[model samples]
Target: MTYEPELPANSSPADAASSTHKPLHHKPVAKAIHPLNQAANAKWVPINKSFITLTRIILKSALERFGLVNLAITLRCVTQQGYRHLILVNDDRDIQIAAVGRVEEFIISTEMPMTPPAERLSAAEAVTFPVDFQGQRLGYLVALVRNPRVDPGDEIQDHPSASDIKYRLNRVAEEMVGVIKRYQTRYRAIYVYGDQCYWIGNSAALRQLDQRIDTLASSALPILIRGNKGAGKIIAARALHCERHTEIVPFIESGCHEWEEDAATSILQALFAYAKGGTLFLRSVDKLSGENLRVLQAFCTQRTLEKTTKGHAESVDIIFSLSRRDAELPASLQRWLSINTVDLYLPDLRERQEDIRDLTRFFIRECALGKEFDLTESAWQQLEAFPWTDNVEGLKRLIVQLSARAEHPLVDRPLLEGLMVSLD
Candidate 1:
């Protein structure tokens, strides 16, 4: 997994994490790594946002009822270099305290807490209550007691017995598991291919685009597609091609920069030939040099010219794209383009904000390969607020890291903040 720049010494969480196909409890783990000591190899995924939030809500209610001050949830992570460590997932803030001594001792100690000295525990008032489930370790729990029992070793009466605490923790953990399941169900993807990604949502913008594609798919008219980077212009072109021909056909993609003045003739000839009875998508016509623009101008004008003059093939569906940010093409060029091709403006992320959640779910499904994933509401807000300057392309890149960084399926605000801050 990738990491951001080393977080400051005092601010980061200790290392530990988890994953599973069917309750994938990881293998053995190293005790704990110093905040400064994030190993070169650590297999980690962040806990889901919902999972973490639900966990905190339930765990806090249950544990605090009996006066426990803090806890640490450690999950196992393995490195590509063959190292193992029980990376800490929940931070001190989430669990409510450092419990530093207890966690560190639990991680490193082979012996049980009863076999250890007072200093091995946190503040000597904390005791390590540990559990292991389906081979995954529940490292320790710390209960801070202010008053001493009359005969402390004989039978402590203040807090619930260890069995009662275990019962409560078990109930809380089970509840969190339900949260994880819900997340997985909610975010599952219906469309995964980049070409089909924009079609995954049901927003009005998407529905209109879908309708437009249907109306124009078989018309064989030259067309223009406009969007920011990764906004799925090429996907639009592909959709047109697929709708027109049920069978697979050639779809050649080239940028306007490739339309050299020196070779415009040969390149156009080659592209149309290769795309015969198929589609040729040329992007960024606005990027063409003035001389090159004249060549495209002549070409489009001919496409609009009478069949009495030499003209390009009727079978080739040639499409062009321009950045929506670009100023409009010159009047004469726009006139011919308007006469010969339909203008199709792609909606920007801002315009399509309503579809962000669905698209993110689909992309995460693609990245996580069906592993359950959940993000907190704030994390979802962070995603929506992101400029997505690179559009769908940038969103996918961010999700790949987001999926791998969490040891569990849940992605919370802090985990996302760490990643987003690094992007700046």
Candidate 2:
């Protein structure tokens, strides 16, 4: 049985009038019957059973664990629309109404249409928005306004007021699309390497980083990720490798500062062997000695030459991370980086302050498990005001600590202030 909202016994005048007119194509079906009754009806038994089973699966799955249903309901409420339909299109181009809001007694077609209706509704003049993610159209949201004004066919359009309505509708649709796409994307737990996942957020910096990773992932050139300490450069590097290479390749990581001059060459040789047909991530390369830097440069040059001449399919892709802004390398090393590497800069937590709330929520989910705490307005202001010197790592640590001592359901100003003072 398809679930829909309940309607009042004494309907409004508008509802009575709408009920009088039959829909353009199909007659309105009987008020949604109980699942058992739907099963008893021979014609609808298979379809109804399948739909119920699918809904139960989705409800239990991780896809619906997020706020997809809540988002649809919220969008419908915010728009003040009497009817809202969210349709999900699968890989095989099959479309199904995944969710609906305020559409209790409406006509629903039994058969799937051959093609989805064009973005605009012609009969009733409703606007449709495509829920797109990463250039792929996953589904659409159609919101129908009650008693919509008819569009007159004219050579020149003269409706000035329609523009404002269109703008508001477009804005709401955009917001709904964003919410859906964010939940659908695997940004929270992207596979990075063996037994590790990168937590990529929805901040603008990370969005740009995702784009850069897509652009440079398949290239043979070196990649240099620059950021402050604890700014997730290493995670970004690993995510890039996971995204670009189709085959499972080894990820060999080393800290350049850990290598002494005498052992640098031997260590690099061993790393090269381990990193064949895969990625080699060098952390804190800015701290390497001049001799060690030269050794790296020579290795890179040799690999580049060998790849060009021998067509080695097992060449290693080098990725370097620089934590300090003022760190300098030798002129030759700098020149090589400039010529052979793609530089990606990750902004500090202070730069993307808007992401603090989302990061806090993520940490709460991770650290608190079932127990949750709400942050008061003043507490949020305090968090925003403080400079995150250690970036996301520091924020996560603070959240974990706060969740441990959360006396009240809400984290208020006094509690946050005390924690901040203690940390200082």
Candidate 3:
């Protein structure tokens, strides 16, 4: 929900939005505030700052900067009245735009069942848009309207018809494609790899890690990414594959403990097939049994072979992930592979309380796409004070649960207190 920037020209948004869980079909969104609008609405015209200068150049090269396409998409969807507008291009037929307006209506109505029938119907009428951004027919729009209520003599005037939305969306899509092309040509500063925006305190350990990932990506060594659960190990692995030296192939990952020893061959075969000339991420390698251990060991020994074997390609890179940094790897395997290690340890939400607000802002915007949910100052304070043992994932769960149950659009301290007390 909290978007840092866009992906490179070679990557698709679907690839960028990759999650293990099936992603619910939701409307595409743009940024909360456009850089263009922010410049226009500033109180005083002072000397331009560096970010502002970059923003200006980015705007000038909107069609070229990969990040700008995402920014532009974010800006459009978060607009006051825009109901889930998608940027579609005639060139890209793989993109499919979901209808979020109806889904939002269903969620709202279901959440507020106690409202008077008249008011409920009135509320429904205002939000129901009849147009959608459908990427078809050199591209156009489609929509679903349920029981449009019209007064005796009144007419549905000034409403955005399907064609109108199609025309506007098509233009935006074309603009986005142009923006993507431009980014590829100019703006060398936009570093695609080792360029992740994250929340980390000014710790020497964390700073060292930031530098290490960049260096490690250049070498074709065995990498072992260690991190706590929910610490974004998968994200790190994906970032590694996107580096310059690696060929763009499907990322193959498997948890060592999840499969039994007998099932190792089938799993390895599947992984070897998926990661053909790409990266193979063995998550929780410490849990592998006697059988799977040998299979891995054999692959590493193949380095001594003079000729490239049928399946053993030099381009195939291997990465491992473990939960603990100091945990001992099985001694037999340790001698064979030198895991160019990266430890991704983030402080828990309670430990880094200052970041809760930023994280909350991110979660709020994400939930708001379906329903209106606001957090009072006191509510934020309550959240900041709580012990978030589960870190970011736990906070997300709480917000989603609260958003589903809250009576008002805005979440106040009282609502949070009531929920917390009930849990206690």
Predicted model with the maximum TM-score = 2
What ranking emerges by lDDT with the best candidate at the front?
Answer: 2, 1, 3
List the candidate 2 regions with Cα displacement exceeding 4 Å.
1-120, 123-197, 310-312, 330-332, 422-424
Instruction: Please provide, for model 3 over 1-424, each residue's C-alpha lDDT reduced to its tens digit, 9 standing for 90 to 100.
Output: 1122223344445644542233322222111111222112111111113222333333234323211111222211211134322222222432222222211221111112324345223432322122222222222111121222433233444555545544544544444322322222111112222222233232333334434555577664567776655455665565555443222244466667765544444445445544556677788887778776787666555632522454435346677877554558777656554543334443334556655775676676676567767688787778988876566667777777787788887788877776665433
Predictions in order: lDDT: 0.53, 0.54, 0.45
Better of 2 and 3 by TM-score: 2
1-424 in candidate 1: lDDT tens per residue? 1111111233223311111112221221111111222121111222444344444554556545555534444333333333332333334323422332222331222223333345335554554454443234534444433234422453445556657666655654444333332222222111111123324444557656766766776554678787778777866776665555433345566676644443443345455545555567887888777776776667655544533353333456677888664447788767766787787777767567877887788778889766778899999999888777777777777888888787777789888888876554
Judged by TM-score relative to the true structure, which candidate is superior, 1 or 2? Answer: 2
Candidate 3's error at 96, in angstroms? 22
Q: How far is each candidate from the true structure, as Cα RMSD in Å?
A: 23.9, 22.7, 20.4
Highest lDDT against the true fold, candidate: 2
Lowest lDDT 10-residue stretch of candidate 1 = 25-34
The candidate with the higher lDDT, 1 or 3, is 1
1-424 per-residue lDDT for model 2 (tens digits)? 2112223344357744544452221212112121222111111011133222332332223112221111111121111134322322332332222232231221122113312334423434444444443344534434333222332332323332444435544544454333333222222223222222344345556556555666777677888988886688766776676554433456666777666554454555566655667677888887888877877888788888887766345687888887564467767767777898888787888777767886788789878868878899989989988888788878878888898889888999888887776545
Assess the local accuracy of residue 1 in candidate 2 as a C-alpha lDDT between 0 and 100.
Answer: 22
Q: Provide TM-scores for the models.
A: 0.49, 0.59, 0.47
Q: Please tell me which model should have the higher lDDT, number 2 or number 3.
A: 2
In model 1, state the lDDT of residue 44.
Answer: 25
